[model samples]
Target: MRVHQLVVNFNATAQKLVNWKMIRFGFVLVVMFTLVCTVKSYTFQIPVEHDKNGEAYVTFDGTKHWLKDNKNLEYMDAQNCTVHLELFALPTEESNAYVSGWRLCPQEFDKIP
Candidate 1:
């Protein structure tokens, strides 16, 4: 009788552990799905031109974002290609922010020639 009682308690503890693991796994999946759905990213090509002071910048929606990185300016001149601006927004952010410096679109680089 004592052995039966011990087995029952052990089974209950094992079931509780399995339930807790499942709850944790479910929470993780929910967070991942929420992030995948809420996170947004976009990329577009825009011409880079130097201002009167010889600083390179790109204009988007009437806003001039200066390129402060020397490497980006060099790459733009070397490739003679328009800059690819990557923009992304976090789940908590209301407005999108630039992903910094110039490069091919990470998510759609293969689609561009």
Candidate 2:
């Protein structure tokens, strides 16, 4: 009888430990999923406008960055003024000039069906 009681108690304790671990794992998963959904990526877009001299300028983070690349013009022309900017690891001298990293979103992505 005593051996049976000890076995039953051990089983109960093991079950409780398993339940506690599952609860902790579920809590961690929820926190990770929330962080993934809410955290913004380094990539974002800024408005591009042409000045009177036809120079391209992008307003980023409340600062106006004048672009000086011919590729930027080609991108703007190709994307019909829609462009996505990816920030570089190191800051450049041209303020927010459109350097190498640029992504053009598909036009159909925002289309209303």
Candidate 3:
């Protein structure tokens, strides 16, 4: 009878150990998944290119989430404008000084469609 009781106790102990290990493994998997998702969401790339007239421009890439438009056109006579990252850093000007080809545009051009 004593030998049978010992065998039952050992089985119960082994089951508890297995459950504990499974819980720990599940927690680790959740943490790893969270880390990967956060990293992917935070960072994005901008696409930059130059035209035949040597004008640099920054455009968005829809396929790769988002891409950076990093083109240093400070010296060049390009109409490329910086897409502001912060809300307060955006240009306050009503119209761009370097822009052209819109001389005859209607006064209510900014009205929403």
CA lDDT, every model vs. true structure: 0.56, 0.56, 0.42
Answer with 1 or 2, whichever has the higher TM-score.
1
lDDT for 39 in candidate 1 is 39
- List where candidate 2 sits over 4 angstroms from the true fold: 41-113
lDDT of 2 by residue, 9-76 (tens): 99999999999999999999999997665433323455456667666666653555566543332234
- Give the per-residue lDDT digits (tens) of candidate 3, residues 1-113: 99999999999999999999999999999999987775454344343334465343334323211112432222211233222221111132322212111111132234526
Candidate 1, 86: how far from true, in Å?
10
RMSD of each: 12.3, 10.7, 16.2
- Report how far residue 63 has shifted in candidate 2, in Å: 9.7
Off by over 4 Å in 3: 43-113
Candidate 2 TM-score, C-alpha based: 0.39
Query: Clash number for model 2?
Result: 0
